[model samples]
Target: MADTAAPPTAPKSMAVPLTAFAVGGVVALLLGIFSKVHDPTLDGTTTLGYSNVLAMKTVVAVVIGVLAVGQVIGALWIYGKLPIKAPSWLGKAHRAGGTLVLLLSVFVGYHCLWSVGWETGVTDTGYHVPARTIVHEILGCIVFGAIVVKIVAVRSKRAPGWFLPLAGGLLFTLLIAAVLTSAAYYIGDNGWPSRA
Candidate 1:
């Protein structure tokens, strides 16, 4: 007698991706809501010996941006898109770089959420928030979501081959956008912190 085992169906194959999306969406939504609802307090805030919190955030953002660039290069090399041959340890280095990025992002994000909160346009002091700041805030939330999705997709065996690349690319784009809208703008506007 011949074996009659059935192949995986479309719905079963899609379960992991769908769950990843849902979890990512929920995380993003929760972060946004919490940031909006939380009261911002900048009193006695320390920037870990930097000139100020913005200086620390700026420096960290720049570092994150650079690391993100490295991550892209590493990924390309791993996937054989680069001309040079990928080293055996490249995968470990890539994972380490990603972990570093996540840690730094969380540090900056915590400061932003705790000290600044989410800003739409005007503040209580009648100060109009720049459009760039608003864009940065939105992107910040989405970037975390992208990170979650990428992590989920990367870990799941059931995820489609195309999903990981797509998630990674999206996360990279979001990271760059967040850094550009925040760190790049700050450097351009404030002329870079001397202490930072």
Candidate 2:
């Protein structure tokens, strides 16, 4: 007698990636909504002893960009894509740097949302915002979304190995773009430590 039995299916799960993407989308959407609905103060916020909030944000963004570059190098080293030998402490340092970046980003983001709100390139006084500023505002929200996705992907064991790298790369690119659109533009237009 022959017995018929069904084969066991693959154990792969899509829960982690799906959840990460969903949560990320929600985070980005919430930020956009809150920024648009909230009334902006435009009174300027204090940070790092700097009287100029824009200048302070720009400086901190540049610092975050530099640290992100370091993170990429560290990731490459860890993955054996770099020629340099990976130190035992590299993982811890990488995590610490990521945490620092997250905290600083929150600080900058809070100030932007609280003071500037979301710029729509049009003002009540007939003043027009530059295209660059508009793009920066969009990127600011997306970057935070990418951050959430990357964090979720990194923490989940069920996430595919490819997902982590993809998420990290996307997050890094978004962050750099945000920095360029805002911080770099501010520097070019008003110079460092801009008085305006």
Candidate 3:
């Protein structure tokens, strides 16, 4: 008699890509909610006498954006998605880049949340801040949360090969969006000060 049994399906653990995306989304949403509801405090520590907090954060933002771009390229190379051959050390470089970006993000986030908060208005300029400011705040928080998800996905043994690349791409996109809306806008509106 012919065998009637069907081939076994791939294990549920293989669905890491989809699960990672969902986890990232949920965590990001939670962070947004937390940022809105939490009370903010004035953090003067980030600002030295000669330093402007906004300018400082902007510098960090630029660094983060550059690092995030490197992360995406490294991921592509490591996953064999890039056209060129990848070197053996590319994977290690990718991990190091990700770690550095995450650490820098923490510093940036602390200053943003503790020093400025939501930034609805500026007393000196009396500039009517647009809706984008709040949106940028929420997006910044989400970027950090998404990074958390990416790290978990990276360490998961059951995660599929595609999961890492997808998480990395998502993280890179979010980081760019946060930097563009906040740092780029600030620099474009007010020229970077020599002192801070």
Candidate 4:
């Protein structure tokens, strides 16, 4: 065989998670805007709270999402220009996005507890499902888990290639599920009061 220089690095699995984060970022922005306008109960709704939490949440989402996207795009660019070498920028964006997602998870988790503990009347419709708070707690836990796994897997040397993106996809699915469920509740006349 002719002499051939071996490629430097293996193909990284950051794309899956990064895409997930990017989708999540876009979904989060949409959810935040929807919550602010339609809910009328978010922090900055009235004159008293003046809370920037929602704004910051949206910002974080966008930052993390964009970073993830940038990572994937950067990797592609690197691969294109130097086909003989290993990918250098593969996980850079994903790492940043995962970190931001972790932060957001913390914020949301704290907010959940705060709203419950302070009796701030955080819930809008009283959540009428059986055991009332189940959805909140369950969804929050899942969100927490997804982010943790994504972060850990991304950092760990033992992580399989699919874990990163799978984690991200899970997060996006959770958000979308919540939003759709809430929207359906608002629209469907399934024994719920009309907001108008």
Index of the highest-lDDT prediction: 1
Q: How close is candidate 3 to the true structure, as a TM-score?
A: 0.78
Residue-wise C-alpha lDDT for candidate 3, range 60-149, written one tens digit per residue? 888899898888778778778889999998878888888899999988887777766665655346877677887788788788777877
Q: Candidate 4 lDDT, tens digit per residue, 61-95?
A: 34444544554445445446445554565556545
Which parts of model 4 are misplaced by more than 4 Å?
A: 1-91, 117-134, 175-196
lDDT of each residue in 1-196, candidate 1, tens digit only: 9979997654436777788888888888888899999998877465876788998899899999999999999999999998899999999999999999999989998888888889887888899998888889888988888889999878877778888899999999999999999889889988776663
Quantify all predictions' global Cα lDDT against the true fold.
0.88, 0.86, 0.77, 0.47
Per-model RMSD to reference: 3.5, 5.4, 5.4, 11.5
lDDT of 4 at 18: 55
Quality of model 4 by C-alpha lDDT? 0.47
What is the descending TM-score order?
A: 1, 2, 3, 4
Locate the minimum summed-lDDT window of 10 residues in model 1: 7-16
Between candidates 2 and 3, which one is better according to lDDT? Answer: 2
Enumerate residue pairs that collide in model 2. Answer: none
lDDT of 2 by residue, 45-126 (tens): 7766665778889999999999999999989998889988899999999999999989989888988888888878579888
- Which pairs of residues collide in model 3? none
Runs of candidate 1 with Cα error greater than 4 angstroms are 1-12, 43-45
